[model samples]
Target: MKTERAKEILVQLLRIPSPSGREDRIALYIMDFLHRLDYDVHIESDGEIIDLVVNPEAELFYEVHMDTIEPRAEPFVRGNIVYGTGASDIKGGIAAILLMLEQLRKENKDLNVGIVFVSDEEKGGRGSALFMERYRPKMAIVLEPTDLEVHIAHAGNIEAYFEVDGKEAHGACPESGINAIEQTFEMLQKLKELEPFKVKGKYFDPHIGIQELICENPFYLIPGLCKGRLEARLLPEQEVEDVLDLIDPILDEYTIRHEYTEIWDGYELSEDEEIVQIAKKAMEATGLNEFGGMRSWTDAINFMYNGTKTIVFGPGNLDISHTKNERIDVRDVVKASEFLMYVNEIYGKS
Candidate 1:
């Protein structure tokens, strides 16, 4: 696809506000775009997800999430970069997918492939879970912000929310009363000493920390209650129950009230797998040679859990995703589109 056209599509997609649970608008735009290409599009999950079938019997498919974080930003183009929310997180990848489909339609090639655009990826990943219940492709390429590298492994996570209670005391007094915030910190420090938190893998290291901490003190007295959310990224070899078993004792020691918000296992695809081999070959054909593990949880986990071999890949730096300064280079979109096309070609031959 032409660079100008790709930028236009990306800009249009970025302008729509499809945050988390609200993805109807962007889903409509995508359905219309696919319809114009004369492909059979199917709307699913109360019109929150879309499935476009280029070949019904195709075992290979591409998937991308349509939701961004809340409060979408206005889209703008400056030189080769397009700036906006969701620009890097996923809208850029969506644009690339559209361009690849458009090119395939223009060429009128009957390649064996399908595409799925799902919602709720930024929140619960229920959309992908729903899709897996209905369709099971032999292989899937999940589009995310990977800067064009093929990611065969993805990190899993255990998210917990806890509340600690302490006796209130004056701020000026020392050792008179317990500080709930300090108690929370102590609990976190002890939890960090768990063995799983320090485990390292060939492509990713474990990340364990508190993502959210809250303690309210409107008066001069120390806070009596503290609430925190802890997140732990586990390697493929780590077991969720094993880590939780180690954590249960520490939480018990602090008498912390906690609950698991989310738990999902990490996964890795063998380098000798056909999908991995073809993806690497496609990246090489397009002058890309990077391969790494996805440090973040992606829809690939759902697909893998449902028995589909999946990989994560796309354009844009994940570091800037979900931030106000999120942006993607127009050239990167073009390169990603080219990469997808090559993947299609190589996979078709195999």
Candidate 2:
């Protein structure tokens, strides 16, 4: 595949607004591109459901996600870099896959490889689960931005939402009701002291975050509820449910007069197996072992949980994934695309 052409497509994908469940246009573009290449392609009607590409009776497969974390922040470029919302998060990775397929198509030989670019990875793995239930491949190469290194592992994440409830009463008579807002604040204070819930972490570069409380309509009446969201980075040995267990008792107290909900489970990939071996070989062949950790949650854990030897490897600093100034070096894009071509050639059959 031509590096220049690949960059163009990468920019185009980055320009599309594919946050979570809204990946219609981008998915359509992928299906169209694959179809034009004379490959069998199916764009699932639900948009964020699933996509399938078959090698006209061939084998092998490559898997990726077409959705992103946000809409494009508008496109811009400076020397050696392209700046946009999806540029690094995985657009560069997707570009690499597209280019790899193009290169294989030129060889005058049947690659017998398939491709699937799913949706909803930013929120969950419904798209991937759809494919996993209906099909299985010789190997699955999940494309996430990992610079040029072969990321043999990725931890999971638990996006948790905790709420506090109270009785609403006239503010004029303050003692008439309990205050859920104040209770939520009290719980937040306790959460800070919960022993840190430590674990033997992996693929953990120690990433963390917190945001302001959700907005609610204000009135003279006491507020009936208060809620906040917290994200925990899942480690190989730690289950996403562990976080829920840690907070369950604290949550149960509120349950007597409130509500409790668990957003989702965190996922993890612990072994260096089939996908890992193939990735390592390709990296070794390319002399690109200088790889680093995923440092956050990704759909890698979903694939791993489904019993597939999945790895997260591609090109881009995940640190820069969703920032307003998000960008990826053009050189990195080309290098990752070239590196993936080698990975596909090496693992496409085995």
The residue-by-residue lDDT of candidate 2 on 154-243, one tens digit each, is: 655555566667888887765898777777766656655564344345456322233445525388877667666655555544555566
Model 1: per-residue Cα lDDT over 160-263, one tens digit each: 88888988989888378799988889998998888788766878888789899889889897778898898999888778888888988888777558889889
For every model shown, what is its TM-score relative to the native structure?
Answer: 0.95, 0.81
What are the clash counts of all predictions, listed in order? Answer: 0, 2
Q: What is the C-alpha lDDT of each candidate?
A: 0.86, 0.67
Model 2 C-alpha lDDT versus the unseen true structure: 0.67
State residue 322's C-alpha deviation in candidate 2, in Å: 2.7
